[model samples]
Target: MRRIWFALFGGLFGAVGVAFLGAFRADALADPTSLATFSLWLGASTLYVLGGLDASIGDFDWYQLVGLGNVCLGLQMVARAAMTLADGTGETEPLLATFGGVVGGLTLAYIGLDWFRGGRHFDLSTFEESPTADPE
Candidate 1:
């Protein structure tokens, strides 16, 4: 029980910290707005994966696997930010964006393959796509 609490809080805090770090790094990127966009997309994806992991109630499963992959991607972005800062306005955009695009692109490919192979659906969620919403 205590371990569950630790994992829950640890995961929550870890994700939040990573996202916050990304937010703080936005200004250092080649184009702050582009990094902002990346942060936004990554933030949404992080929240979604966290929600799934939370729903699983700390079980070790696919949700955790997805969350782990997300962590990998987030670390890369953070590393890019650090590199950009270190370079101090050198030709960092291409390298940073290329790395992000490659990793994110491959992630999307894996996700698409898994989805087509009957993987988890982010859609059909009772939380998001509630059937009882008032027709507006």
Candidate 2:
């Protein structure tokens, strides 16, 4: 069920990205850095859904991991936005969007770390047995 939602969200993001790219001119899209960053985010989002499902067992408590992925994607988007601003080719809209992206990513990353520290309350037993546990 969660996987479905992740996949759906990723698809939606991809659609928006596609539209954004389509509306832009070819010369802008030709940027290798921009293209690579976008590609990485797309790939990461896709993997998040697929791999998350595979790793989860209805109790995987993956909010932190998912959050991390979200942050990563946001950072990429923000970087692209910053580039757009630097190039001075687009309106201020991209700059604002980039700022928003960076903020969103930072927020997500903070939440993820917080959860990892204590919010999620993951059980230590879930980890494989340590050699010391045997005490042979």
Candidate 3:
């Protein structure tokens, strides 16, 4: 059941993330508004995935994935802000945006594949215990 939820989340948000990243990378729009819009979409996708994972896992340790996604989103936002402020006045490396895009893209691909494949296989264990007599 948990795995199913995870798959659903991955399939949905993963597609959105991939789309936003691809657009940001390939589009020729250089304006701050365009970049901001892309960043917002990426951030939204990140949050959605994180929330879904947390709900499905039900463990604090499972939040690491969410943290990583948030970090990537942060990087994307920071890069966009810096780029907008610079406004071509000074040379600046778009490292944050590029790295975030790469990470998001790779993660989306991995998550989508895993979701489609029905998730990783794990051995299930069953236990039996002696039954007590029923009272009349």
Candidate 4:
């Protein structure tokens, strides 16, 4: 069941990433802002797809993929906040968003690193356990 979910999500993210990259290519010279937005989306989608693949195949540490995803999301949010602020709307929302993104991204990355280093902050045995645990 989890593998199915991962496969579905991976396909979705792959499709979205391809679309975003196509759009970026089409309007490559349009504007710097669009470039930033599209690039961020592309990065996030790619990371998500990779994470999904890892989840499905058990080829890598789940926390690492999750951390990467969180970092990408944070970057996207920061970019959004920057674009909003650049519009000269004088809104505090952008500031808050940026702060939130930075804090969230950093925190997640830290947690991921700890987990990767065997910190064992929480038992993730459910995810680690697999029917293929024994080679027979």
Best by TM-score: 4
- Angstrom error of the Cα, residue 95, model 3: value is 21
- For 1-136, candidate 1 gives per-residue lDDT tens digits of 2223324544565577577657877454556544554554455355445444444535544344444534444554554545556555657676677567657655654553443343575431222323465878
Name the TM-score of candidate 4.
0.56
User: Mind sharing the TM-score for model 3?
Assistant: 0.33
Sort by lDDT, top down from the best: 2, 4, 1, 3
Error of 4 at 121 (Å): 4.6
lDDT of 2 at 33: 73
lDDT tens digits, residue span 1-136, model 2: 4345655676676777677777885754587777766775766576456434545535545554455555567567667666766787556776677778778766755654554454554432333234455656
Backbone clash total for model 3 is 0
Worst window of 10 by summed lDDT in candidate 4: 1-10
Go through the candidates in order and give each one's C-alpha lDDT: 0.49, 0.59, 0.49, 0.59
The alpha-carbon root-mean-square deviation between model 2 and the true structure, to one decimal in Å, is 9.5
- Give candidate 2 misplaced runs (Cα > 4 Å): 14-29, 55-65, 89-97, 112-136
- C-alpha lDDT (0 to 100) for residue 29 of candidate 1: 52
Weakest lDDT window of 10 consecutive positions for candidate 3: 121-130
Give the per-residue lDDT of model 3 (tens digit) for 5-84.
43355457668767666777657346766666565545545554654454544443223343344444445555555555
lDDT of 1: 0.49
Which prediction has more favorable lDDT, 1 or 2?
2
Tens digits of per-residue lDDT for model 4, 1-136: 3523433564676687677667777675377876776566666556556655565435556545644554555565656656666777656786777667667756755654554554477444545436665767
RMSD of each: 12.6, 9.5, 12.2, 5.4
Off by over 4 Å in 4: 1-7, 17-29, 55-62, 91-124, 132-136
